[model samples]
Target: MSNYEKYLETQLQDLDFKEEYDNLEAEYQIIKAIIDARLELNLTQQELSAKTGIKQSNLSRIENGNCSPTVHTLSKIARGLDKQLVIKFV
Candidate 1:
C-alpha cells in the first residue's frame, strides 16, 4: 500500500475521517487514473495541457492529487487523449 493508503487506513479509525475519506475515495481514484492515462500515452503535462486547454501548472496539480477537477474538465481531458470517460458502479 502507498503511504497515502496507509494514512487513510489510520484515518478510517476515526468515524468522521472515515466518512469524509469514503466520500473522496472515488475522486482520488480518478486522479490516479488521469495521471496513469497520461503516462501510458507518454504525454507531457504541457502536451496534455495544450490538448485539454488546461494550464500545465493546473495539470500538474491535478496529477499530483492536489486539485479536484470537475466532470466536464475530466471529459475534456479524455477527449484530448482520444479516450472516453465512463463511470461505473460495482
Candidate 2:
C-alpha cells in the first residue's frame, strides 16, 4: 500500500477514528464507486455532467461529499456512462 494508505490504516486504529470511519463508510464507498467508474471510462466530471445533464458543480459536490446524490441523480449518471447503478444490502 501507499504511504498515505498505510497512514490511514494506522490512524483508523483509534476508537474514535474507527467509529467515525464506520459511520461514513457507505457514503465513502458510494463516492469512490462513482469516481472509479468515471476514471475507468476516462471521463472527466465536466464530460460526465454534460452527458448526464447534471451540472458540473453538482457533480463536483457529489464527488467531494459536499452533497448527497439521490437515486434518480445516480441513475442518470449511470445511464450517461452506460453503466448500471446497483444498490446492495449487506
Candidate 3:
C-alpha cells in the first residue's frame, strides 16, 4: 500500500474506537430492524402507537434505539406490527 494509506490505517488502529464502534453498530442494527418492521406494515409512528397503545414518543425512542425496550413492551409492539420479537445471544 501507499505511505498515505498506511499512515491513515495506522492512525485508525491507534485510536481506541472499538467500544464506540460496537455501541453504535448495535444501536444501528436495532433501529434498522425496528424501522424495517414498521415500514413493512406501512405504519407511521402515530399509527403504530394507536395499534400498540404505546405513546408515539415512546415508540420513537424505541425505534431510534435511544431507549431499551422491556420484553412486555417489545411484545406489544411485535403484536401490533404482526411481527415476532426474538432475543438471542451471540
Q: What lDDT score belongs to each candidate, Candidate 1 first?
A: 0.84, 0.87, 0.76
lDDT of 3 by residue, 1-90 (tens): 544336435645644654564557666566667777888778999999999999999998887567988889988988888988887879
Model 2 lDDT per residue over 1-90, tens place = 544358668979999988987999898788878887888789999999989999999999998889989999999989988999899898
- Tell me each candidate's TM-score: 0.70, 0.80, 0.69
Better of 1 and 3 by TM-score: 1
Regions of model 1 farther than 4 Å from truth: 1-23
Off by over 4 Å in 3: 1-19
Q: Report the C-alpha lDDT of model 1 over 1-90, residue by residue, as the tens digit.
A: 655558757878999977886888887788767866887799999999999899999888887778888889889999888899998899
Name the TM-score of candidate 3: 0.69
If ranked by lDDT, best first, what sequence of candidates would result? Answer: 2, 1, 3
Give the distance in Å from residue 31's predicted Cα in candidate 1 to where it truly belongs.
1.2
lDDT value for model 1: 0.84
Per-candidate clashes, comma-separated: 0, 0, 0
